[model samples]
Target chain A: DVKVTQSSRYLVKRTGEKVFLECVQDMDHENMFWYRQDPGLGLRLIYFSYDVKMKEKGDIPEGYSVSREKKERFSLILESASTNQTSMYLCASSRPLAGAASSSNEKLFFGSGTQLSVL
Target chain B: AQKVTQAQTEISVVEKEDVTLDCVYGTRDTTYYLFWYKQPPSGELVFLIRRNSFDEQNEISGRYSWNFQKSTSSFNFTITASQVVDSAVYFCALRNTGGFKTIFGAGTRLFVKA
Candidate 1:
């Protein structure tokens, strides 16, 4: 089974504080993504990394950043936490590479998610 | 820009009954992919189905079936004889042709009663 693990299942942070959400995949997938899930807005992409040290901004990348120092791990960073930024963070990994189907059709394996609340 | 839409926000069905969830998408490109995922109460997302644009043939797997209509730009999922275990939030997604980006719909919550 493909496993995607998130560092924290729940977290609370104060405004102006820095936060890091971590995700690790055991399948050695080359593509990783970060998304925030809200009640009505669904999952909006924050950032994605297709290779180590390479990252691309998604639709909602204004308030978030990411780091990928290794192939199996991807981290999402919030420069300064805000109440509006409090939401469920999901991390996903896909195998072979991005967009190309060297293996499967690049379906994402998502983490259980981390629900963050900023006070 | 490509987008996916799930018109139904909530659906209710009794055990052993049938239910259908509707999904519509917008894009001129014919080389895209569509997907459906389920998120149960445990909060873990599960992959349900994936349909590429070129393959328009409908699919049936046990009690779950999907109808893909290219002309209407719609892909609908139906569950025959729904069980209580089928209750969850269903999301429709679309992947662009040349990008790793996958856009998801707002999702529909399905409630299967005993």
Candidate 2:
């Protein structure tokens, strides 16, 4: 079965501390995304990578960054965690490439989210 | 800019009752994709369905159904007999042609009570 795996299901960190959230996908998909979910606000995209070393900022990229060093792994990095940054973070991957078979790429497979609490 | 709207923030219904979630989207592009996703209390988004602009057919998968009306720019989801396990936050999403990213609507939280 196709799967996306998140390293931590729950994380608690102090304010001003650096944090890392890791994600890996076994499907060999070409596109990966990171999003933060808050009550009522839904899931807001933070960043996405189409290929290794290629990244693009999404709607709310502030206070967050991403790294895609390898095809299967995508990581989200917070330079300094703040109380407001506490939210459920989700990781997703799309098959093939971004533009190929637009219909096929439209569907995304997501990983179980990471709930981060900034103290 | 592409945008998706899920007007219902929360809905409560008794078990075995039918429920529908409304969704409207706006985009200048002629070709786009619409999707519905289910997020349970566990917080992971599960892809429910995907419909493209060229296909206007309403789809039914068992007790779950979707109405896609291109003229009105609406894609609504309905559950024939909702159960407690059906309780979840449903998100409507849009992806414009040639775009790699998707825009998600503010999810509708559904609570099914027995």
Candidate 3:
């Protein structure tokens, strides 16, 4: 079974505080993503890493930063937490199918998610 | 740019009734992937189905079926005889041609009444 684990399930932080959300996947997938999910906005990507030390900005990357030092772990960082930045954070991993194989990159394994509240 | 849309924000249905969640996508690439994911109250995402662009054929698993139309760029999911346990937030996602990242819709919340 594939397992994606988040460092925290629920977190509360004060405004202007720096926060870190950690994610780890045991599936050894090459691609890792960070997304924030809001009530009506659904899931919007913040950042993604194709390989170790390689990162790309997604739709909602402002006020957020990501670190992928290792292939199995990806970390999402909030430089200065604010009320507007509070949302459910999700992490997912998948293998790129292009040039690889058809069956390898079909689905993504997602983490349980971490709900963050900023006051 | 690629985008996904789920027009219905919320839907309610009686138990054992049938309901369909609509999803439309915008992508210029001819080859792509569409997916449906269920997020229950527990907040864990469960992958329900995935269909590639080449395979537009409909699929049925138990009471769940999906209709994929390339011309209209729609992938709709229908749940028949919906039970209380079937209530959740359903999201439609599109995987781009390169298969690097996936874009998700706003999601439709389903409520099943007993």
Top candidate on TM-score is 1
- What value does the lDDT take at residue B13 in candidate 3? 99
Q: Best DockQ goes to which candidate?
A: 2
TM-score for each model: 0.96, 0.95, 0.95
Clash pairs detected, candidate 3: none
Ranking of candidates on lDDT, top first: 2, 3, 1
Error of 3 at A42 (Å): 1.3
| Model 1 C-alpha lDDT per residue in residues A20-69, reported as the tens digit of each score | 99999999888899999998878999999988999999999987899999
Per-residue accuracy of model 3 over A1-119 as CA lDDT, tens digit each? 88999999999999999999999999888888998899888899999898999999998899999999999999999999999998999998887665764333368778999999999
Give the Å shift of residue B13 in candidate 1: 1.4
TM-score (0 to 1) for chain B of model 3: 0.98
Worst 10 residues of 1 chain B by lDDT: B94-103
CA lDDT of A41 in candidate 1? 78
